[model samples]
Target: MYRERPAAVITGAVLWASEAGPDAPPTRVLPDGCLDLLWSSRAGLLVAGPDRRAHLSRSAAGERWRGVRLPPGVGPAVFGVPADELRDRRVPLDALWGRAAATLAERLGPSPTATALAAVAADRLAAGGGPDPLAVRVAALLAAGATITATAAEVGLGPRALHRRSQALFGYGPKTLARILRLRRALALAHGGVGLAEVAVRAGYADQAHLTRDVRDLAGVPPTVLLAR
Candidate 1:
């Protein structure tokens, strides 16, 4: 089973995936500039960092996993690590948090479910001073295909300042973020059964060739393969 929902105390979402059959294939997790605190039935708590490309993960049949996905720019504040260091990485929570990780592990107890994991994330966010509204705005603007210069002006940040913040928050510059966001937009449209050419235009790509290149770059596959499952 797989299910997801908006989180109550945070700006992102929570999701859980469990084995459906004995021969279930590994799942492909796409990049979306978010970080996750995951609790696995076999592995306890782990941190799944932001990705620049898709990740393939497998679980034994009947094994369950729960995760709290934090909004971009919010994980560093809660975990006390730079986004750049964690990019494309998954590490044991204890590695980053030591005693705090152990305490949280105990609080989550055995067989931690998604709701319990979300509670732990909520507590951590409260302790870390909560989510930054500006980061949310920056993400929204970028996802909407706004130019970095225009986004900076709207957010009242200079170009250099925005670049620095983007690095810390997204582990990349605005241009890279825009590319990722555009890829996501195109994929969403494709999933909705839109033609590839129309998807490119709607997702702000220059053409179908541009969309295909980006899909291959970020997803490690062409759009057709990615959308086929």
Candidate 2:
């Protein structure tokens, strides 16, 4: 059977592998069928998988681990987003990877230099689309709206124009981005052995089934499947 080899589920908060060093065996984070965001403090960090079905490798102990894989045609990239904004909504992974990502990702690496990546991340975190007046105002309107039209009106743009900006920078539309944020929230709650039911409640879903479906659609696996690993 096709099974994930070498990879071991270390703990609730982080996925770990038991090799002598962090470089014992590499862990390939095959896209977890979700916008999985991870941060690790290890040497030779072999992480290249984008927000989608990403793969990672770490050669430490005599072991190797290939993380869960994603299905076909996953959209968006979701890395380096703020811890607080994780539950924003169903946004595109790639859309979030602009100048903002450059800053946050800098922190993840061992550059040993004072990089501006964090500052960029800070700007986006505090103002998402804000740094830009139009972007910020529009995003704010979207935030207060119950529908897309309301959000557009608040931002002073037509559907087409808003669509372009969202696609260019955020990878997903405002509503979709919102869903990505929601997924992050669900993921955090579901991190440990939290039941799907609880995850749904904590993430503001209708129920466990809803949560499971939501994750499955984005991550390609049911909630149980994700947490089980």
Q: CA lDDT of each candidate?
A: 0.83, 0.43
Model 1 segments more than 4 A misplaced? none
Query: Ten-residue segment with the worst summed lDDT in candidate 1?
Result: 11-20
**True lDDT of residue 189, candidate 2:** 66
lDDT by residue (41-113, candidate 2, tens digit) is 3332122232432234444444322222211111121134331243223333345565644554465454321
**Model 1, span 1-229: residue lDDT tens:** 6788888777666556564467888888888888888988778899988888889888888777888888777887777787778889989999999998898788768878777777777777788787667778899999988998999999999999988888788777777788888888888898888999999999998899988999998988899898887
Give each model's clash number.
0, 50
Per-model TM-score, in order, reads 0.93, 0.43
Q: Residue 109's C-alpha lDDT in candidate 2? A: 52
